[model samples]
Target: MAQESSSVLARPFSALTLQQAWRKTNENPEITKADVALERSPRQEADIFVGNLIDERHGGPITIGYGRYARGQSLTEAMAVDDVMIVLEERLSVSTEAGTVSAGPGEIVYMPKGETVTIRSHEEGAFTAYVTYPPERPAHL
Candidate 1:
């Protein structure tokens, strides 16, 4: 009594709803705060994260968007709002041709527009935060 991928309504991976994943991940004794912090990027558009230990190193002459994701289709295709995030004190970092910088506690850096950037972290702790962009207001305020 099982269903095939084609018959399924949604993707298996995508099936993990935010609430479900949070609960399951938290319950999984094998999973730890450190594990979450080290988890790879989800690569979901509209993703947002806060907190984590980020660090980056300089690379050959290449403009790098310290906190930006690679280009993709629509904003949804690329992380925009609440996707691909780093937990606070999670050892996150970004390396650019110009220089390297790391986010500090209570510090946030928006991904630069049109730039190659890499983000990573390696820390241990219960990473917790959320991300959401503001709605359109007005220009030239």
Candidate 2:
């Protein structure tokens, strides 16, 4: 049997305001890796870079992570929890089982639990987004 792919769920908020906030706080913003349970191969190039703002390990039920996708890179998966994503810079193309949508700077996108989605960045530049989702415990644990 083929293994199912892991997805990210997210709802986007205003990108402009968030970008401004990031600029103002860029000097020393707290960032960490997202704590989602997924398998990734070391040989695979890291197309997505994530910095966590809040997570379960930090004593929070909601997980908030900032992500940057390199140009031409795409991430596709089915989420295990509800998610929200806010575009911070450039543009991102989001595709779901229902349809595909394009979000630019300051736009927000929402993805429900168990929904399969694909996110990609344009070749002109990298795409940045803030993603948030409820903490989920892996079934194996």
Candidate 3:
């Protein structure tokens, strides 16, 4: 038998723009790169930036962040948590086990844990999005 945990009721919440979140994250020195797990392509670390918005400190079960990728920059990693990504600007190519899909401004994508995803900005101008995910689940689960 499994132990039960109390379920919290969901409520309405407020949100901030990508730029606003980015500014807030930068203002806090405690939110370091280690807190924002990003796997960039070789030699492209400087081309990608992630600004965390909501994390454990926010008292929420999920973390949200803003990611910006310079043209020609790419990042690849297996999803450690369920993630929802909403493209706010430019174009992004998301490659997964199913196939590669292209999303432009106003598009949203969902990826599940353990799914390998490669996000690339292939055109002029930077690609931006709001990404949200829950805390990584234990491997034994």
Tell me the tens digit of each residue's lDDT in model 3 across 48-119.
Answer: 766554666667677666576878877787777777766667777777655676666655566677777777
Model 2 C-alpha lDDT per residue in residues 19-94, reported as the tens digit of each score: 5666654655454223332333122355666555566777787766666677787777676777677776777777
Candidate 1 or 2, higher TM-score?
2
Worst 10 residues of 2 by lDDT: 1-10
- Per-candidate TM-score against the hidden true structure: 0.31, 0.68, 0.62
Write down the lDDT that model 2 would get.
0.59
User: Highest lDDT: which candidate?
Assistant: 2
Where is model 2 more than 4 Å wrong at Cα? 1-16, 27-46, 136-141
Model 1 whole-model lDDT (C-alpha atoms): 0.31
| TM-score ranking from best candidate downward | 2, 3, 1
Model 3 sits at a Cα RMSD from the real structure of 10.7
**RMSD to the hidden true structure, all candidates:** 17.6, 7.7, 10.7
